[model samples]
Structures are given as structure tokens and as C-alpha cells.
Target: MIQSTTPGKMDRLAAFIEVFKLRIAVVSTPHASSPGSPALLLAGSEDEGNARVVFRLHGFSEVPDDVRVVAEVNFDNEANPLMSALPDEISVPLGGSVALQATAMAFLSEAAEGRCGRSAALNRLAEVLMLMVLRSAIDSGAQQPGLLAGLAHASLHRALVSIHEMPAHPWTVDDLAASAAMSRSAFMSSFRTTVGMTPMAYLGAWRLTLARRHLKAGEAVKLTARRAGFGSAAAFSRAFSRAYGHAPADLKRAGASAL
Candidate 1:
């Protein structure tokens, strides 16, 4: 079934952003080239940064030469699915969109002013910039199979969003197909084609991703395992070690939070 292309289609994406915490800071301009170019650069790999966002602006010829805004952002989690699913570089030219241009100018002004709470304000602006870029990316779609490809699909996004919002819902192929409003075979075929993984496999990976987050925050193995729908700690540890090349305990930090 064809789904609406309107605004609410992406409503569930907000949950991912909520958990996908990132750090934004203003960094010095690395080099001077192509003034009048305002672009958003996303880090391609874990080495660079998972969800790192860099918005660099060399003021357009129309604006004063003094305005230059260069800021870098880093996402705290390496396992952010949104970043993992995207290509190495998604450049958004601010000049293309009137709304984006206005926002970029405001961001640049905020960064240059260094007023009270400048850091906080800049971070918020960076978020707006990131959101805009993400929307563009989702609309443009990806050539390869991944989350972006799946989300860009009208029917598939519903199931993907459901899976994302409730990773611990004990999802199955049939259930996921129902969520997507497709037959079991059709859903499996489309999901695998677009996401490059079977529905159950993606669910498992997503669960492990969340479990690792909790483990790194000092949550106990058994607690995380149970919450992740694992039968026992041993089973969970084996899967975790295979996926990350380290035991879950190795990720635990100094303090523990309520799991």
C-alpha cells in the first residue's frame, strides 16, 4: 500500500533522535577555501566520528567578508543507526534553500557574537542544521541497502519505525509484515532488499546495540540480558562478544545506572 508522503510520516523518527545523543561544539576553521560556501559535512567512519556534524561557512559574496562560521559536532555513540546507515558525506548547500540559508546566517551570527549561552545556542542551531540535512538525505534516498533506503520507502518506513521504537517488542517476520501492511513473504523480501538484513536479524542487532549502551553505562549483564530478551547472561555474552569482539563486561564504566 502507498503511504502518505506528508509530515507525519517521519513522526516516529523523533524517538531515534531522542536516544541518539550528540555533542556540538564550535571549532576553528581548518582552512580557507571557497568562500560563500556553506555546507554540512558528516563523518564517514568511526575513525572520523559516527554522527559527527561539521557546518562550515565561508560567507557568501553577498554577505560581509568578516562572517565565517565553522563548528564541529560529535555523536557520543558509535552505534547510532542513523549515522551507520548513511553514506560517508551528505553535503547540503545552504544557498539552495531559503529556510536553510536563514538558519545558517543565524547560526553564524550566534557563533561570532559569543554572547551569554553562546555555546548552548550554537549547539541548538547545529541541531536544526542537522535535522534539515537528515530530511534532505532521507528524501534523496540511498543507492545501497540500509536504514536510509528502508526509511525512504513509503511502506517499509512504517515497519522500520515500529522496529526502531520498540526493539524489545519480541518482533517476528509476521508481526513486522503486519506493521508494514504487507504479506509475510512480501515484507520479508522488501525488508531484506531495502535494509540488507532480515527483519529478525535487524531486530537482534538493534537489541544488542541498546544492550551495549546500557552495559557501557554500568548496567549488570543479567539485567541487560533479560531486558534484551536473552535467555541468560551466558547467551548474551556470547552474542555480544561475537558482535563487538569484546565481552559485555569490558564495556562497563565506573558507575552503574538503573537498568
Candidate 2:
């Protein structure tokens, strides 16, 4: 019998952004080489400095603690993948063609302007920059294990897609291995090596991530637990608390307080 590959709705990289709620804040600085050239910089500050452009991933939150900063990069003459090449706070140079730089500069300029309806335009431009950075990172070849490494590996990418497509599925090592067309042992080893976590560990984290969103949206604990593939609300609460450093109830209360 011929086996079918599992269907994936979103690209793994895009799914990563969704799961983590990543956002981009761009600040334009004076170009070092050319005084008049506007150098677009990705910043961590929530405040848009001097009318900077901010682009948020899907389901962005204004709360700083709620946002997870996966990695930070400093663009240089050479473009490289940020996640795998550096530790938590390392800066990597972003290298791209002249055309790419020109396009980015144009977008930054438009984003920085005070035109009406510019927020929407800035958002679109920020999305473009995110893709550009990803492309440059892939081209540079990531040497470390991370989302970048997983994307670069065929088997790992397939596994990642399956996980993201069906987060509620009760997945197992064997099942994921089958999806990736690899033996269970090989799959387990390769996944940990590339993604920097065991398959089940990653799945648990993914589930809790989804659960947080549901809870924030005011879903009942039982419903959120079920949707996140936990056996019971109690179990889900424990896992959620462990991962987020707070009980689900606390988060729910905080969410309510915000309103």
C-alpha cells in the first residue's frame, strides 16, 4: 500500500511565528557609510523610536512579558541565519544583494513617513522584511540546531509541518518518524539534534503555547486543555504553569484585568 504524506496548511517558518507570537520593531538610524542613507534596524523596544515602524506577528500582545524573544540579530555585511548561528543574544550580519537592500530601504522610508493609513503600510513592509531576513539566513547556511536547521533539513521540515498542522493530535515518536519517512530511532536522534529538543518535549511546548492563546481568549480551562491535547484540565494546568512560570488561572485573571 502506498503511504500518503500528512497535509500541512502553513509553512513551518510561518507556523513558528504563529506559535511564538513574534513581532518586529524597526528603527531607522543614520547609515554609517552614507549619512543620508536610512539604516533600518530591528529593535526590542516597544516604543517606536522617532516614528519607527513596528510589525507584529499573528496574535501579537502589547504585554512585554507575554512575548517571547527567540533570538536577536545585528545585521552586517554577511547575511546568516540568526537562530542557529548565535546564542540567545548574539548579533549576526545580514548580507543580501544591492537590490534587496534598496527595496528594504524604500519600504523603511515609506514606513517612517507620517502619511495617513501608514500603520497598515508599515505592517506589510515589516512582513516583507521578515521574509527577507529568513531568506538571507537560509542562504548563509545555519551551523547550529534550531528552527533554521529544521527548515534546512528535509526530514525534519516534514516532521515540523506535521506537528504544526495537527497540534491536537496525540503524537508519538513512532508516528512522527513515520510521517518523516524515517525509523523511530533515527527520527528521534535527528529531531533532537536539529530542533534542539526531543519530539515529545517540543510537542508539549507547542500544546502549552496553544493553550495560552486559548486561555487569553477567555476559553474555559477544560476546553483549552482538550484542544491542546491534554488528558485533563489538571494535567494541562500543571504543564502550563511549569512552562509559563504561572498558573493558568493567574494568566486568565491578568487577561481579564487588562480589559
Candidate 3:
């Protein structure tokens, strides 16, 4: 039986939690793009040949397509490949945007979880999958690192790993610099050259991201705030609102009822 705090409200919360958790499970699981967990690629005849589906966690879009997307869930930005480069077929012949939901996550679950240590394994696997996508995209000439070409450098990889491993470690420039085994000045310089943000900013973004996921999973706000390293629920709310454009309460309400 499901747990509940308020009659109708509990049902709504559970539904919201299930939807987001399922999405996370699919994305984080191995074999997310396999036959069993296929991604929905919406593109035109022209796009069919050129389009590729790239899934990256935290720093990248959930489903990065070079076409417009129509789906129930999303994690994209203005820089999203789909928003920027969707093929003409989507507008001309496909009749509308493409929708790919649930199927891909299904396959990912089968391959990633191995039917044991599911969510925990996926937590580690998400980074591996992201790196694979990044390497492939760069090799295939689909993504350009621009002046940030150093982003593909080894230091960037190290920094990413450090952030992922100690997301709640109250990281600072000094801490991250120590992790990267470089002086504060050098680490900051190299990090900016490749990753495009100052160390502190990146840390904040990473923390906010984890907080958002916990929120989606129906974790209590105060708990989520503390785990994400915020000092209090109010602080977490202010930061979350600033980063995501919505208060934690508003987001919880939307996730529960408006999803």
C-alpha cells in the first residue's frame, strides 16, 4: 500500500513522485537507448539521417535531439540542441514535433540496473553515459567545444568527477582545487577555460540540481535542503527559486498536481 499524509494530496504526491522517479530511472539506467528502452526520435526525412539522440545528466539535456520535442517531461535549456537545430521535417512533413517517452528509459533500466542495486548503480552510471555521449558527439562533429576546446581536456574530466562524488561536501574553490591537485588559481583558470563557469557557481548548480531531483521524488523540503547543503528551508527556497524560476513549494505543488 502507498503511504499518505492527506487523502487526495497523498495520491497526487505519489503520482508525481512515480513519474519523475521513473524518468530518472530510465535515464540513469544502462542500455537506455537499447531496443527495449528506445528513445523517441522525432525528425523529418532529412533529419532521420542526421539526427542523433544524446542523453547527458545534470549538465546536459535529458533528451538532446536536433529537432523540436513534444513530450510530457523535459530538462532542456535555450542551448538545447532540439531547440536550436530541429530539422525542417518536424515542421513540414512530420506534421508536428516528435514525442519519445518511457520507452527509452525502459531499455535503460534493463541494462543499467542488472536487476540489483538499481538506483544506486544508476547514480554512478549516469556520468559514464554522459561521458560516452560527449566523446561521441565531439568525435562525430556534432558538438563543438569552441574556445572552450580545453573542456575535453583531462582536467575537466577530473573536476566533473570530483563534483559528482562530493556534491554535498560544501565544496569551495579551495576544496575543488585540492581535489584536482592544482593550486586555486590554476584550477579556476583551467576550469573556466573548459567548463565555462567559476568553481563556486558550478557547485551551486550541481547542488540545486540534486535538490530538484529529491523534490521530484517527494523528499521533504527541509531534508532536501540540508542534504543539498543549504542552511535552511528558506535559503533553499530562495536559491531554488532563483535557479529554477520557481519556489520549492510551487515546484512540489506542480509536480504533484500539474504534471
**Which candidate has the top score in TM-score?**
1
Better of 1 and 2 by lDDT: 1
Reference-based TM-score of each model: 0.76, 0.63, 0.49
Q: After superposing candidate 1, which stretches have Cα over 4 Å from the reference? A: 1-8, 30-67, 95-98, 112-114, 253-259
Output the lDDT of residue 86, model 2.
Answer: 32
Worst 10 residues of 2 by lDDT: 68-77
lDDT (C-alpha, whole model) for all candidates: 0.69, 0.57, 0.48
Residue pairs in candidate 1 whose N, alpha carbon or C atoms collide under 3 angstroms: none
Counting clashing residue pairs in each candidate, in order, gives 0, 4, 6
**Per-residue lDDT for 41-156 in model 3, tens only?**
32223335443334322222243444332222232322232212222112122222132222224334545347876655543343333323333333232233321233235445
- lDDT, residue 140, model 3: 32
| Deviation in Å, model 3, residue 20 alpha carbon | 9.6
TM-score of 2: 0.63
